[model samples]
Structure formats: structure tokens, C-alpha cells
Target: MQDPIDAVLIGAGQRGANDYGPYALRYPDRLRFVAVAEPIQERRTRFAHLHKIPLEEQYESWEDLLSTPQKARGALICTQDQMHVGPSVTALQRGYDVLLEKPIATTPEDCVQVIDTAAETGRQLHIGHVLRFTRHFQKLHQVLRSGILGEVINVDHRENVSFWHMVHSYVRGAWANQADSSPMILAKCCHDFDLLLWILDRKCKHLSSIGQLVHFRPENAPSGAPARCLDGCPISDTCPYFAPFVYLDLLPLWRDVADTSTGLVKFAAKTQLRAPGLVRAVSKVVPFLRQMSDYRGWPRSVLALEPTSDAILEALQNGPYGRCVYFCGNDVVDHQVVLMQFEGGMSVSLTMHGHSHLEGRSTRIEGTRASLNAFVGFRGSWIELNEHRSDRSFRYDTTGEVRGAHGGGDVELMTAFVKSLQDGSSQHSLTIARQALQSHLLAFAAEEARLGKRVVDMEEYSERYLS
Candidate 1:
């Protein structure tokens, strides 16, 4: 067996610690993390403890970590959206191959700079468009290549951002404002753009987009609702987005039960309705209740480093995670859609909205001989095909046990990166910087089209920004 590749991590946030860090733990023979740089003391310390890195190897900033000579064969850049370009360019220049988290940078110029740096330095650069490594998407690509769907004509894709997830990540969380992060389409749906470009195997020729912050504004807040849900909001009993209901999972059991009703069942429902505080207290006494309440994993883990019951409650009471979704000053769109014209006369439409009940992605691809419909969700994933002139139909259950986030793509992407590093080859990489730039460009162009209210020609957009 090949020796494990040594890598350094530049950020220890959610994706860094939960998604990619666990990969090394699971497959120690393939990869080993030698060092980490995280600004947050708690996160940096926790990540070091988990990975067993020595005190000398952990740094408080990416600049401090990368300022020295290259410490490892590769660097995993999982910094925030705006912090990506600097670490990536510096890492490549310092003789380290890079696996950068997606939406490469907030701007086209910065993205192109990373690509140019990698090329100029003669080092490998892999963008974290993990959807390409997923089993469901890989199977979908196979079915398309088999001509089972014949010549594809058009495609419709939907990124269903579950309501809780929208409020947690985009509404009140890190990506709520475009000025702080990239646009919603780029930050959230760049994976979708990369998927479309990869599966369709064509460059988008022209595109236009339309969307806005239609909901989740102060005007949409219920009458008498306060800025914070914990501030004795009037609609707590009925609001699905009440902070406790979302974070503590304390919504009423019977959705139709009236809060004023008098009965054993109704009483139990009402008790459950007000159990967030009780649950938080009891979780401290009974340790297992923490897992039952989902305080150890994502949506909750993103809120705190420790993610203890008390920690979560404290975050809710004062942190961004606890803000009322409607009252939070989130400027990213609650919903958006993009339309693209690809080569070979194929058209595609991507709709991304934050009002879904479940988090998942669904797509419908129409071809000459058959139509294919597919869905990949947190609960399960499936793909179905139907013939045009006949009654023949086929179904595939693609829901293999998901190891980590992104439909098991995270693990698979890490595996690919490990293999590439082991062999000193880019052939194992799914998408390099230059190819991944296409999807980023598509996102930038779509944002321009949405804001400018005009169709953007790919050639013109590329020359104006990329050239």
C-alpha cells in the first residue's frame, strides 16, 4: 500500500472539522492531517485534539501557518468564501497542491488568479465541487452517456433548501448577507452549476436569471413578533420558525391541535410545545438526550464548537443563529432561478428556493427517446426513467448509506484527493481550477443577468471579466 499523504488544514469550521476532517479519521491509511490553522481558539484546539496534531503545528491564522515553508504535500483550504483566494494562491506559490472549498472566490478575477497561480507554479489545484463524486450523480452521468435518454433537449433542476436549513445557514447564519459572503446562487448553488456543466458536458453559451429577497424580511414578520424569538414572541405557539421549535426540535406533535384545547393529548402537545427549556435542562442531566435532541451534529454544530445543550441555548439567546428569520438582516434571496443555453441547442433551468420542507435536489432531463427524473435528498435518493412512445419505465434506488455531508460526496471527494496526492497525478481529480472556473463564471454571469435584467453572452462576459 502507498504511504498516507500528509496534508494541512487552513480552517477548522463546520466543513473543515465535520466534513473533511473526519475523512482522515475514517481512512487513516490514505490521508493524515499534520497541521491546522483556525482563528477561533475553540475550533483550532478541538480540531487539533481530534486529529492528534502537536501544539507546535496548530496556528491561529492561515498566514501564520503558510508563512513557513510548505509543511505538507497538500493544503486543504476550507476558509470562508472571501478568505479562499489568498490562502489558495499562497499555498500554490509555496509549493503545495491545494484542495479549495467551492465558489473558489467571491469575484471572477480572484478565481482566475488562483487558477493562474496554480498553473504558473506547476502545482495541482482541485475545487471542492463534490457533487461530481457522488454515486447518484455518477450513476446519472452513466445513464446519460449510455444513450438511454437519447439526445438530451432540455433540463430542469431544483435545489430545495429546506426551511430550517435556509434560516440556519442563509437567513440568520454566515451566508445571510451578500456583502459578507458570495451571492446565494454562488454560495449555495455553485454545486448545481458544476453538476449541470459536468453531466451535460457543454459550456453555457448564454444565460439570464431573476430572483430577490422576496420573504424573510421585517415586513413579513408576524404582527407583534419581536426581533428575537426568545424575546417572548407573540406567535411562538404557532410559528414554525420559532427559534426553539427549529433548534430544540420542540414543535407540537399534533400540528392541528389547538394550544387552548383541554385534553390529555392536547396537554401533551402543549407540553411538548414549551419543552425547549426543559429539554435543554434535562439534556445536561441525561447525556444521551443531547443526541436525541440533535445538538451534536450539523445545523447545531455550526452554531458552537462544543455544541452542548447549554452552549446551544446560549447561542440561540444571543447569537446570529437565534435571530428571528423574518427580522434578521439577511439580504440574500429567499428564492432564485437561473436559465442557461448550453452548446448543442440544449437548454437548462435551475431553480433554487429556501421554502422546501426537506433539503434535497431534484432534476428532470428530457431527451428524444426517454425522460429521466431524479431526486437526491437527505432522507433518500432515487432516479426514474420513462419512455416517450412506450409504457416502459425504470427505477433506481441510489441511496447508499451516506457517510458524510453532500450525499456521501464529501468522503468520495476526499478519497480522490488522497489518491491524487499519493500518485502525484491530476488525472484522479474530478475537476481542476480551469474547468471548475466555468461553473463559477456561470454563477457570476447569472448574478449579473439577474441584477442587470439582461441576458449575458458567455463570450462577452468571459472577455470582460476573465480576460
Candidate 2:
């Protein structure tokens, strides 16, 4: 039997601790975390304890962890957007292959630097473009490749960033500002771009984009609303984006539940039947219920290490997570669209909006022979293929049995990463730095086009930034 790969984790935040970290625990035979570096003491300690790493191997910063060459086979760099490049480059130079959390870097130059450093050090650098590893997308790619659709002509894709998710991760969370992180497109929709590129297997020739922060400004706040949700906002009950509704109520309820159609219906009924007074009473009796419905995972986990009801309440009351979405001073766009002309005559459009009722992705592909319609959501995933000549259609659905986060792409991505390392084959790597660069470049170009209000030629953009 092959031995498991020993890896170090940098920045034990959401992705590190909750997403990728759990892979080690699930399949210790495939991967093991030997060390962790996180500035936050709570996160660092928690990750160390979960992974069973020794005290000597735990470090408060990436610098300290990589100060001397360690014995780990690789490093998982899951730091914040702006902090990705340095640790990634350092890890490569320190003789550790890296699986870096996405956006590679906030800027094109930094992204290229990580790619270049990896090449120079002869180390593997995999970007976390988990969408490509998903079964739904893989099936989509397979159908497209099968030529059942004939010559592809155009494509339309929509990234429906659920309203609550937009307010949580973008408006009030870590990626609220473009200057602090990457643009909303890069931070959130890079996966979309990567998926499109991978499935089509064509380079985008030129593109134009337009978007802006239409809502979530101070002007949109209710007249009597306070700065924070816990501060007695007047519209707390009616406001869909209310902080408590998300952290205290919805996220917890959906923590273990799949957020499927039936799950959402049940959630709606529960919320509607129970009055605010009843909810408060229940929470008082079961304090932890206030923070998370009954589980201790993401959204709430992002708030506190312990994530007890008291800690969650404290975070909501005092931390940024608790702030009013409209008054949070976030500047990223609420909606955006990108139009791209691929190398061939095929054209594609990608629309990303934060006002979606459900968090999912939907796409339509048109071809000479037929067309394909697909949707992948937390509820489930489905695909329909229509043939023009035969006048027939086929549908595939996985309605029940909830897929894990990111449509079960997270675990598949980790499995691929481990397999690549085990076999020591770059050809088997799904999201190598160079291949992932295409999406990042496209995202950067899309942002530039949006800001400059003009079309960007891919050749010129790539030469100017990447060359």
C-alpha cells in the first residue's frame, strides 16, 4: 500500500479548517496534516488538535513554519486573498509542493509570480478550482465532448450567488472590498471562468464587462435601522438580509440539512410558524441554538472557534459578521456580466448576481445539432439534452441525497490533489498553476473591461500582464 502524503496547512480559516482540513481526517491513508500555521491562536490550536500535529510543528505564521525546511511533502496555502502569493512562493522555494486556495493572488503579476516560482523550483502548484473536479461539471464536459451537441456556437452561464451568501461572504465578510481582496469576479466567479474554459477547451479572444455596486450602500438602509442587526434594527423581521436571520437562524437550520427543495420548504414553514418571541424563548432555553440551529460548522464556525451560542451571539453583536449589510461599507459589485468571444466564432456570456433566491449555477449551451440545459444547486443537480434532428430530449436528475459543499467538488479536488502527489505526475493534475492562469487572466481582463468600459483583447492583456 502507498503511504499517505504529509502536508502542512497555512491559514486555518474557512477553507483550511472546514473544507480541505477535514479531507485529512476522512482519508488519513491518502493525506495527513503534519503542521499548521495560522495567526489566530484559536484557529491554529484547533487545527493542530484536529490534525494531531505536535506543538513543535505548530507556528503562528507561515514565515515561522517555513523558516526551516520541514519534512512535510506539501503545503496547503489557504490564507486570505491578498496573503496567498507570498506563502505559496515561499513554500515552493522551500521545497514544498503547494495546493493554493484560489485567486492565486489579488493581481495578475502576483499570480504570474507564483506560477514562475513553481516552475523555477520544479514544484507542483495546484489552484483550488474545485468546480472542474465536480461530477456535474465533469458530466457536462463529457456531453459537450461527445459531439451530441454538434459544433458549439454560444453559451450562457449564470452564477447565482444567493442573497444571504452575498451578504455573508462578500458584503460583510472577508471579500467585501476589491482593494482588500481581488474583485468580486476573481474572488467569487473565478471558478465559473475556469469551468467555462475547461469545458470549452478554447481560449477567450476578447471580452467586455459591466457591473457596479447598485445596492448595499448606506442609502439603502432602512430609515430607522441601526448599524448592527443586534442593535434592534426596525426592519429586522422583514429584512431578508438581517444578520440574525442568516447566522442565528438559517445557517444553523441548514447546517446539517441539505438546503434541498424539501429542506427549504421545511425551513420556510418553521420560520413562518414560529414567532420571534418563540424563537427567543427556545434559544434562551437552549443557548447554543441561538448561534447555530444544532450544528457547529461554517458561517457560524467562521465566526468563532468554539461557536457556542454565547460565542456566536458575541460575534454577531461585536464582530463584522453582525453588521448591517447595507451599512457595512462594502464596495464590490452586486451584479456583473461578462461577454467573451472565444478563439472560434463561439461566443459566451457569464452573468453573476447576488440577488438569487437559491445558491447555485445554471448554464445553457447551444450547438448546431442540439442544445443542453443544466443546473447545479444545493438542492440538487440536473441536466437536459435536446436533439434538434430527432426532436427528443433526455433529463438527468439527482434530487435527493444532498451533495456536499460545492456540489461535492471539495472532496474530489482533494482526492485529485493527493492522487497527483502520489503518482508524481503533473499530467494528472487538474488545476495546475499554468492551466488555472487562463481563468485568472480572464477574470482580471473582465474586471479591467468593466472598470474601463471597453473590450479587452486577450492577446494584448496576456502579453502586458503575464509576459
Most accurate candidate by lDDT: 2
Q: Model 1 — which ten-residue stretch has the worst lDDT?
A: 252-261
Q: What is candidate 1's lDDT per residue for 66-142, written digit by digit as tens?
A: 99887899999999999998999999999998999998999999988988888788788889988888889998988
Mind giving the per-residue lDDT tens digits that candidate 2 earns over 1-467?
99999999999988999999989998999999999999998889888998999999999999999997767888999999999988999998998878999988988888889988887777888899988877788888888888899999999999988888899889999889988887999988889998898889899999999999998999988898888998988888789888778877664235223454455444543543355455456666766445323546777788888777788889999999999888899999999999999988899999999998878899999999999999988646888999999989999773423255777888888888888788785543434568788899999999999999999999999999765
Model-by-model lDDT, in order?
Answer: 0.84, 0.84
TM-score of each: 0.90, 0.92
How big is the positional error of residue 465 in model 1, measured in Å on the Cα after superposition?
Answer: 3.8
Candidate that scores best on TM-score = 2
In candidate 2, stretches whose alpha carbon ends up further than 4 angstroms from where it belongs are: 251-293, 398-403, 427-431
